[model samples]
Target: MEENRGIWVFIEVTDGKVEGVSLELLGAGRKLADKLEVPLAGVLLGHDVRKISAKVIEYGADIVYMADHAVLELYRTEAFMKAVVAMAEKYKPEIFLYGATPNGKDLASAVATDLSTGLTADTTMLDVDPEKRLLEASRPAFGGNIMATILCKKHRPQMATVRPKVMKALEPDASRKGEVIEEEIHLEESEMRTKVLQIVKETTKTANLAEAHVIVAGGKGMGDKNGFMLIHELAKTIGATVGGTRDVVEAGWLPHDQQIGQTGETVTPKIYFAIGISGAIQHVVGMKNSELIIAINKDPDAPIFDVATYGLVGDAFEIVPQLIEKFKELIKEKGGEISYV
Candidate 1:
């Protein structure tokens, strides 16, 4: 355990570009490393991904462990797992962080099993006990009612998978410099059990709430499907994206893709309008990071008020319609054209 000394973030590269979540993790890991007084390192693996090492350092990594190989062109579990495991055994980082994307989750789980270390999945918050040198990985637990912080007291490399959009990435610094250590992969394609067939991308059109600049998210307090129409009306009028709570999705008022909560997608918009939301921790965890949170609910003491920048204690039906009209008038004043994004 004493041999493990630095913080490591797995930099996921796709189509010759680093993933946003990887950059976010690098920003987060940098803080932990600074507090622990250890170097922040990034583990980069993929074919032709050497160019991304510089970006990783600009994001906050002091060192990048890169492995560039043809077999790693696509994300194959066997190939990635072997490469990461070998790096872990050699470098021995005190803490390891991965994005909660599909590929990241798969790789982290495999690596944790092989390394026999404890891992916390879907972590929304991360902290460290500098004295004890423990990673405090917290996430919604027991149906998202409360947050539970998991710790790996006995493990050498405390690993965690953090949800995307929950953490903010630091601004890039091109002038920042870091050391890139290239590692040679000893495994070949013949030794791998799984082979990449063909990749298929989703072509469906859906509400991209994660990337939306302004989001109007409603909860069950909106009454029903008809009441939910107000959410869409306000969103369309303002050119903002529409999102719903889990209850709204379960009631078939909105599609699952538009649900915002712990069990759904996490979002960080420039402005978030939480209408008729009671603000359960589950729901708050997804949108608490919004730059401006304006919550409207009938309950004067709704938990949403706790984290909201502005709280409206009234019926959303009356408040939202008035707001919609106000926005429409404002848009009409500006040549009937408004862009929120």
Candidate 2:
């Protein structure tokens, strides 16, 4: 453990750009590195990814270990795992963080198994003990009822796969400078077991709740499918996106993609309207980072109010309709071109 030094974030490149979650991890790793008084580094692995090392440094990495090769052009678990494992063994970072995306999770698991290190998956919170040099990775456990912080006491490099939209990224500084260390990949395309045949992109049009400026998320308190329409109407009127709690999705009121909670997509919109939500810890972990949280529930003591910026203790059915009318009037007053902000 004493041999390990610095914090490393796996910088996943997609479409020739850094993934948002990877950048977020860099922001998170910065704090841990600062606490431990160690340099923050990033592990970049991909073909033609040398140009992105500077961007990684700008985000917060003090050093970037890059492995540029054609075998890594597509995300093959075997290829990425070999590169990451080699870097981990050679450099020996104190902590390693990866995004909890499909590819990120796949690569992290393989690397952890090869290195025989413990990995905390779907981590929502991260902290480090300066004295012990242990990475405190917390996530919802026991069916999302309580948060359990996992520690890798015996491991050389503490590793975690963090969920997206839960952490904030640092402001990029164009003038920031960092060291780029290029690692040699020992694998070839012929040695790889998996090959990329073709790429199929999803053509379905769904509400981009994660990037929405404003979101109207409802829960079982909305009563039923017809009652849930109030949430849709409000969102539509305000030019916002519609989201739902797990119960709402399970009840067939909303699709799984629109679900917001520990098991759903984490979102950090500009404004989040949590209507008729009781604010379970599971649900809060997903959207608690929103800029402005407005929770409307008949129960004044609902758990949601604890984290809400504004709490409306009233019937959502009555309150939402009135709000819709007022918003319509406001839109009409503004020539039907009002922005929700």
Best by lDDT: 1
lDDT of 2 at 272: 96
The RMSD of every model to the true structure, in order and in angstroms, is 1.6, 1.7
The residue ranges of model 1 lying beyond 4 angstroms of the native Cα positions read 203-207
In candidate 2, which residue ranges exceed 4 Å CA deviation?
A: 203-207, 339-341
What TM-score should be assigned to candidate 2?
Answer: 0.95
lDDT against the true structure, each candidate: 0.92, 0.91
Residue 229, model 1: Cα distance from true site in angstroms: 1.5
TM-score of each: 0.95, 0.95
**Residue by residue across 30-86, what tens digits does model 2's lDDT show?**
999999999999999999999999999999999999999989998989999999999
Clashing pairs in 1: none
lDDT of 1 by residue, 1-341 (tens): 99999999999988888988999999899899999999999999999998889999999999999999999999989999999999999989999999999999999999999999999999989999999999999987898777899999998799999988777799999999899999998878889888878887764324378778899999999999999999999999999999989999999999889888888878888999999999988898889999999999999999999999999999998899999999999999989987754
